[model samples]
Target: MTWNCRGVGSKKFERGLRFLIQERNPDVIGLLETRVNFARAGEIFQKLGFKTWVAVPGMGFSGGIWVAWRDEVGCFVEKENAQYVHLRFSGQGQKDWLATIAYVCPRDKEKQHFWDDMAQFAQITQEPWVLLGDLNDIMAENEKKGGAPCNSRRCELFAERVSNCNLLDLGASGNRFTWKGPLIPGYERVYERLDRGLCNPSWRCLFQNAVVKNLTRLSCSDHNPLLLCSNDSGYGFGPRPFRFEAMWLMHSEFDAMLKGCWKGEGGLKNRLMNLQPNLLQWNKEVFQHIQNRKRKLLARIDGIQRKISNFNRPSWALINLEADLQKELEEVLHQEEVLWYQKSRGQWVNDGDRNTKFYHIRTVSRRRRNKIVMLRDVNGDWVEDQVALRQMAKDFYVDLYSEFHEETVQEKSLFDNCTVSFPSLQTEELCSMNREITKEEIKDAIFSIGAFKAPGEDGFPAVFFQRKWHIVGEDVVKYVFHLWQDLEDLKEINNTLLVLIPKVDRPDSLKQMRPLDYVM
Candidate 1:
């Protein structure tokens, strides 16, 4: 839990802290703006049942940060500054992870140093990481209300730092604003969401179902505490649909597999349909080998560690073997990173950052955001059951497209009376618009589109054609030529998948969704 405890030395703040610790029983607690000396902070930590604690002294009683955790959780301080405390933690059977508790200075000039420190830390750390606390900043304009408007430049810089660090906002529930100013009238009641939880991609992978909730503000403090909870069993357990990964193109055997599958097809579409089954089989047999190798490497590393621990002095040969295994493990991990990075579809993040954690979080966040947890039906009733929700969406969309009403004569006449005109095109302009598509133009058009986009109904993206152009180019060009020349109904090629995106935060009704057409 992260909280800005205005001043821990005060009786009211102390009482609030005690109540919070007793009520939540969190494994770790990070407090900012404590405004107390180290000795007093130590006494409070001891009384609060924290066996290990660290505190950074405040600047003349205006700012102080403290991080405390129970003895059961193994925690070691890795780094600390006036603005943040970084710690490495490990527990029984759990992977070691990093946590940084930060409290940014309210002053604008000091914020840059805080961001610089964080960026440096992110660059050096390679473990699962979570950074939480009051950033003293807002990411969006709407995050603040009743102020002289949040500094747009400041918010942009803050957002850029988050992106550069490869962090994803774990999105909070409960109150929209985490910090409130004095309740003065005349546009003085400032409110902002200054506190949030941000984590790296690895942390999201480890705690895939984690949620950050901004609890109600305590009476003694203006800031609300954020509670991070992990619900491991909340994710869907259904079998995942097969997706052709862009990373697979990097493999030596991918081209061979495609060539083998393409040899036995009829039309372009039929060939693709038949090739899918073979590709699925290849994924299971060949692509899955990478994961299998990872598991074997992990087993070998564990076995070697056990042997080294048992020996009084490990032999040189054992050390060499461990180093080799570690190197191979790192390479396998990089491959896995590439696989997830391609799957994430996060184009904003740079490729060299090795932001597998960011990619993992993006995928998880998208899944969670898109999930229909509950829906309001036509009868104005909320439906929670998965089958019921599915039926509701299905019925809503089906009726939307299937039901058609004939236009009345009066309504038809409204359009008939309306006249629209445009300037006439010159002969040269007309000729240019009517010109036939060249082979080079078709190739350029296909290449110009994003190669890693989501596939349409045919289950193929532009990348497939671009990568296997040598084998499939002739059929594709011929099909395009015929379609352009004949100008006939191409219903199969024209088929599209309709995807619904929410137009507002927390859309409960079908009318709130906007449809996007994904043409095959």
Candidate 2:
């Protein structure tokens, strides 16, 4: 669930990694070379839901480390040697465990002292640990991309120390390299497989199903960050629900209707629950049917319309009846001759005038008469037919309504969280105690709450601590005001009397505001 990603002191890369952490919402994030002051690092990690600890002495560009875990997690930071952070996790009715993250300098002449310091750390812990970071050594040439020979001294030293300490190098699969240099004009991509994760046997079992993928280089950093996924066997696949634009769906029109409903004003949770069932049932039984019917009807109506338009030809019977229909034909023919004369020469002389005028009148008369005769015999509908047009418009809107608003059963169940565990990793009681917790307690609880896995809904936002409120006992708000005169973050947003009491028999003093004035 956690790994040491050498951010390489790139602010842009760090920002991208921070974005990923926020998106994934991980419980623990082990980062190195954060290139930030300890206070800034703490603030950044805290916003992302982790209680962070940074290495001291501000080595500037030389090197630094940061370990961040959820507030409820228990941990200890040993800064004496090699800067190892030991983390522990404790849960009700379950055995407790520990994990660790550190950045060990490569075993080269320049950085031999740091590697030596790690040996002492390994000796002291004497417990299961998962150590991860950039060790600056290649285990084998095959592990690197375009790699030459391995750094034998550093590699042999790291391997011997880890093996002697009973640590297993949990090698990455599906990847041959972890770090890559920037693009050069003429040279091939320079790469080094430096970052790694090594764990004790105990940690191995927990990470047996874990995956670490080399993600794309987010910024200008040479190293592509690794994505660590654990307890995610069923994370990717599921019956995803149909999602509608809630903001669009609940427009001003739906606002009044929603407000009038009991569930609408309660909160987002209540409104969703109210809409879920109706959508689910509609989606299950009617959505697809409506879509198919709409398509078919549209196709059929289009065909009928096209046929009416394309089959507009006068029949022989109509032409033969022209003599019997001489009066009607003459009237239409005269109107056409008048139109042609006016459009051609602004004169209404018609066939009795010039030869050119007569020819024009004959041509126009034949075309006009042909159209009128076709309508009278084969397909002559000149009026708008308002009723039929209106029916078609109504059907189109009705079909659109079904296609958009209908919800499905499967989608409803997805939001409902049918298979979810409760109480979070840190139970309510523990979480209450951890709020505004001491640095020592923060360190001690790192692993329990960090490694303790649960779906997001189980977790409570850190915002709860930004304001003081009642959780367990009555008159708690009064105590908060009495103790902290200026608790800025812990401000009261709202307050309500759980039960109203009859006041006629009470003293007038009880009705008057006193210390209660500030709270109200």
Candidate 3:
């Protein structure tokens, strides 16, 4: 849980903190604007049952930050400043993660320095990281209700910092505004979402079912506490679904991997099922390792650039190393861009525009916006639990399509009083539509489709076949030939997934969504 405690030294603040701790029972707690010294901070944390704690002491009761965790959560302070405290945490049998608790200064000049510090930290940190607390700024005008409009310059700087760090806001629940200012007689009161949770993609992947909730204000403090909850147990039972990433096509081994898996015997459907296991194994061995190498290369490049910037007379070897690393980084970045671009499903942006950052932002924005946080059921009751949300969607769709009772239709004789309006198709013309599909026809059909279009349940986009046509072309042609020869074969390959897209800004009912069919 993260909160801007105002001043933890105060008895009222301390009591509120204890109440929050008891109510939420967070494994880790981050406090901003603590307004206390190290000794007092340590004593307070110890009394509150935190086995490990760290603090960036307040200066003359101005600003301070504290991060405390339970004994089971292993972590150590990596860095700290007047504005923030960073910790590197490692749990047994779990991935390591970095957590930063920050309290940005309200002054504009000081906030610039805060952004610079965050950017530098983002460059060096290797683990999945979460940065949260009172940022003292809003990303958009809507984030502030009655306050003066947010400065565009500050919003731009904050957004740039977040983008550079590849961080996505973990979107909040409960109150839209986390902080409120005092009300005046003639002027409107100020309310802004200054407190939030931001994390990198790696952290999101590691905690796929995690959510940050902004709890309602229960104390005198202006800022509400934000809680990060992981609902891992609620995830549906099954093996993780297979997803085809465009980045995989950039790997040298990708074509060979497909060719090797496609040679199995049996009908097309069985062959695809056979290929699934091999592809999954290849992903584990190839894709995962390449991601690790890419991260290391980025870290090394960042370190070398920092050295060059600091030194007027950099070593010749250092310069050459930087150049070599940059060349490699470019290739990896292109592949990464392809991956994000495919996921974005955007048409306005094009390749060679060096707009990977834009694509990344768009992709992240779509995911966050599409995510269902809360839903109002038919009874007008709100459902927040993940499992309940899924069940609600399931029931809605089932009831929508299910036939409770059958309707009787009046039978009419076609020859009773009908007059011919148009001539029927000749036998030859009818047979033409059923003519055999050729290998060339199959190739033309595959190539005609957009390469980057969304993949179906089979997890293979059109690009996969187009790029490796020489290797997989024969098998594809044979499959199409079988379908043309036997109409029954079409049924085997006709399965599709129904993707729901919102038709309104904020859809609250099934009727407000449009379903698109995605055939494999």
Candidate 4:
């Protein structure tokens, strides 16, 4: 979400941001310009129940980047000397993910510094990360509608920077232009896809199903918001056909059935148990045959779709398309229903036709196809209601798990090789400080304490508290207080007591050590 707010203060921009958040309710948003100081922006975001990560370079008349995330997603902003926010999405038992939002000045020689800084950050983390923002450079001649004739040098530099980081641009969907100049009646308005999102190869794969939505401007800012929606891709179409075996139908009874059928005779039991392989193989073949026919039908439909897309005049094409689709749908309805009924004995239901077997096949096939189509549609669209969305979401996760299982198995090697180490310090040093408790232990204790709450049991767990501690600088023991802190709204989790511990490494250190227990 790149916007040239001209010179809007934190207050006005915040009201608008709140309105947008309420409207879209996106998990994350990237904002630009935001002439306000970093601290002021943080307050505005906090007021909206959002954790803000801002990158404001000192005293320069340049734009800045800020990302405001929902309170639930634990995000921390790493404030670097350079003008960019490094945000890490953290959670239990999950590999952490990082995303950086930047605002590059279009007319700065220091622009090179931004890329240099980002490249260094990438080299440092080497984790799955996304770097997205208004790069202030258009890649192609076609990308700029009326902006100053495209600068090949700047574009090349941006490309080189991205290549150096091994980052990729998620292909733009819908209109190519991201920002359009207010048009004068005769001449066409200049437009350019300056706002962009780039990610490492690993993160690219993670967001394989994610989409970059080019939204129409509400005339609030010069640049339109680019909404990125990462959805589950499991229930979607791919190169291979997904399968659910009929044997799974008897999965609940498998143990009992096997025990009863092959309990006594050793050799015979072995032979019977071995039959599982043949049974599964036969079921797979049956499933594949059905899948193949469905694929063929889908291919035929897609062929028509391609023709329709290529047709210069869509209105004329729709005439033939509607008739053809109707015929194809009717044929599909019949074959899916009638043939399925003949094969299965009252096991299936066809929702379209009253016959059980036929109804099951046709309705399921149609529903499945429709679901796939919906998945392929643009992001943030309400293609279906809650039930359909939930099912699709579930399917996507299942597919993701299946596809990534091998990758995850391979990731063990990476994890093993990863320099996952804690900063060296003894337990005695921790015990010496009144804050002997590790930060991880504190977090865990907070989480555990909240676990007893019904909301936590129901999955929306959170804890809110105010912390006061003594800040010691040798002879000076200055006491400062931090208040009304919601664990859900924690960003960065930096600034520790006594300046000794890093907050990120302690995941379960506080599980048994309560903050009150320390006083006790």
Candidate 5:
């Protein structure tokens, strides 16, 4: 946890500290702007049952930073200054990582210095790392609510600092605005999200389940407390859902595998469902470790080039081998990009676009933003138990759909009397609708859907049918003919996975969300 308590000398401040220590029992905590000398800061934390502590002396009574931790997280100060403290810490059986907690000066020039210092740190630090603190600046203008208009130049500087460090914000839950200013006469108190956790890609990948939540600000200060959970809370629902990966299409063996697995004794839907297990097994054997494969291929290519460079009489076979490996590496890289792009759900990416890291960051950030750590029940009570949260969500949708059914039954006749004002289909249009669906029409409809669109329960995306049309087209067209004969055959094709998407940021109630039907 990290907090800028304004001043930590008061009894109230100590009481709050005591409460926090007992409540969360965090492994390590950082106190920013403690406004007390090192001795006083030590005295307070030591008396509060912290097993070990360290501090940077205050600049008069306005600035000081302190870090204290129990044995659970061993903290050794690698570097320290009035502006920030860099620590090498480890806990919970994980490898050591770096944490740089900062208390940035609010002035532009001082913040600029902090940015430069951070950029320098970025260059040297290669371990999994995170930077957290009351940064004293917002990343964007919208991060400030009622404050004097943010300086666009300052905002850009902070964003660039983050980019230069290759750090992505861990994003926060609970309070969006973590700091509030003294009330102005004509306006309410200004608010801004000045405190946050930012981690480099390695750190994010290291602690994929890590989260930084902004707790309510202590009454003694304007800045909210940040609680960092560096490991999984053990609330994960289940194994990840399977989706048809577009990257699999890039594999040379993918088409042959489809041809072998596509033959089965079921119709299109059942055969598609049967193909899931085969695809899963084939993926495990073939494309399971794409990155590792890419690394090895690149290494081989490098070795081959080195041999060619060092030996003027390098064999003709050697050159051809190098060319083959390069082609294979290109294909693997393309597959990896496709995988990232699919996860990113980015519409801007095209076939040749290769901003893989950008897509990865977007994918990770979206997961963090959409994660539901807790919810509020209908009684307005916070529900934190994960299983209970799930049950509550399930019950909510069940009741919602039930109530709608009852209401529709009661008002079913209302629609019966409603007259259509829009243009009605002509006899020719009606005849066209009833005309037998043809093979060409089925193929056109299949291609019309987005290649990577969310699929039905069968898990076969449009791209699967589009690319393997020669192999699967006849069967798909036959299935369409069967469906036209008996519309009830639609049962297998209609299974869907209902997913709830939040309508607002940090939504706590089930009603504050909408559902998407993922046809299975």
Candidate 6:
């Protein structure tokens, strides 16, 4: 829970906070603009049940922030200043995470340093992190009402900083505006969405059920409190979709694995159909343990460093072991970046800059944004149950495609009734258009495609063929020529999987989505 209390010294404000604590009892809570020094803040917090707490004294009754938590919450301040405080919670059975509560200065010049600090935090930490409190700015014009039209430049800057840091906005569920201005005689009072909750992809992945709700504003303050709730009952969307990772090409045994799968199949398509499960198994054994491998390497390196520091002179063998561990860690980090970059689908950015965390966050944001959480049915009623939604999707597509299939069976004499004369291609022109494809042309076409583009339903991207040309080129050539020899059966070679993607942020009806097909 986070609230810009404005001034906690008032009897009404103090009573309100006490009532809120009794009702909600949040794990961690932050109070902003307390208008109290450390000594006075301590006296008030003594009555609260929380055992651990940190406070930034107000600068002569202007601004202050306080963070407090119960013993089991295991919260401690990692970094702090007058503007913000970064807290770390010890995760007993899961990975640890950071929470930063900020009360940004209203002036842009004074807040630039906060943005710089946030960027540094993004680059350095792999932990799931969340930020909450009054930021003193809006993200878009729509987020402000009754204001001298929102400064687009300032809004853009705030939005860019949030995006660069890979922080996904944990959109509030209640009030559209968090803060309201005091009454002005001639001019209308202003309201803006300055206070909110935001978190990195790691955090979203960690707490998939996290939600933010804006509480009702109290009579004592202009800003409303925000409640953040998160749980760990995460479930998968459906059967795991197999995606061929680019890092698989980096493995020395990838060729051998492909050879094993290729030898027992009927054709290129059959072989590819059989290869998906094998690749999945291979990935589980080889690449899925990257994070664990990194941890072990780090532990070993730290042990060696400590050993060397304790000794007057370390042995050559010990030094060599440390060097080897360091190199292995570097390779692991690189492969990790490759993994996240592929998942992120952000090929526009060049690699080799150690952007693993950034990519990780990007992937999370994309998933959250794309997921169909709720939908409106034919009756215009909302449907949110997973099973019902899935059934609806299946029925809708089945009916649509079935009708389309029926319409496509039009007579071959569709143009026979036309009376107007039209230009026709010569026999030689027809031959040129339907000419046999050459092996050289096929090779050039495969090589020309981007290596890491989206994979087909066969779970293999162009990069797989581009890299394994030496082993699979002949089979690929034969498959292409076989389709040319029997043009009627070409649909067997044109394998595609149609997937529905939302065309808008909040797609209620199925019509708001479009079908995207993956080529094989």
- Best prediction by TM-score: 5
Model 2, TM vs. native: 0.40
lDDT digits (tens) for residues 1-520 of candidate 6: 9999998879999898988888767888899998866667667777887767899875566679988887888677899888899998886687789999999888666689888889899999999999999999888887888846679998999999999888889875456689998656666789989899989878887876676767778988999999887662332377867778888787768888888778874778787778888888988886668889899999999999998888897788889999999988888888788888888888655655888867886787666555565577889766656789889988877876784644333433565555788899999998997887899998998898887788777677888899999988888888888877883378775778777886754456887788888784
- State, as a TM-score between 0 and 1, how close model 5 is to the true structure: 0.86
Whole-model lDDT per candidate: 0.80, 0.46, 0.78, 0.54, 0.82, 0.81
Better of 2 and 4 by lDDT: 4
lDDT per residue as tens, model 3, 469-519: 887777788778767777445766788877888785446566568877886
Q: Estimate each model's TM-score.
A: 0.60, 0.40, 0.64, 0.45, 0.86, 0.65
Answer with 3 or 4, whichever has the higher lDDT.
3
lDDT score, residue 231, model 1?
49
**Residue range 1-520, candidate 4, lDDT tens digits:** 4454544474556566667778767877766776656667676667777764454643375576666767677788765444567788888355778887777776666677887887787788767787777777766666677635678886777788888877777644434577767676666777878888778756754444555656556545777667666554544544432222222222334334334443343332243345455445644553234446556767777777777778777766555775776675565455455444432323444466645333343333332323322222224443323356456555644554574544556568888889888897689976776553445455444445422122211111121111111111110111111212232222322322111121322111211112211110
Worst 10 residues of 4 by lDDT: 466-475
Worst 10 residues of 2 by lDDT: 369-378
The alpha-carbon deviation from the true structure for residue 439 of candidate 6, after best TM-score superposition, in angstroms, is: 1.6
lDDT, candidate 3, at 207: 69
Model 4 root mean square deviation, Cα atoms:
28.5
Superposed on all Cα atoms, the candidates' RMSDs to the truth, in angstroms, are 8.7, 36.8, 9.5, 28.5, 4.1, 8.0
Candidate 5, lDDT over the whole model? 0.82
Pitting candidate 2 against candidate 3, the one with the higher lDDT is: 3
- Candidate 2 lDDT tens digits, 1-520: 3334444345665577677776567666766555555556766666566655545422545445666666565555534234455566565343455666555554366356655555565677645556666666666545555434455675666677677666666554323466775556665666876776666655555434444444445554556555555444432223444332222221223333333332324332344446555544544553323335445545554554555556678555544444334543343344444434433333235353443345353433332221100001013222223344335434544553575755557768797977876855657777786455343443333323322121122121121211112221122233344334554334333432221132322112212112211111
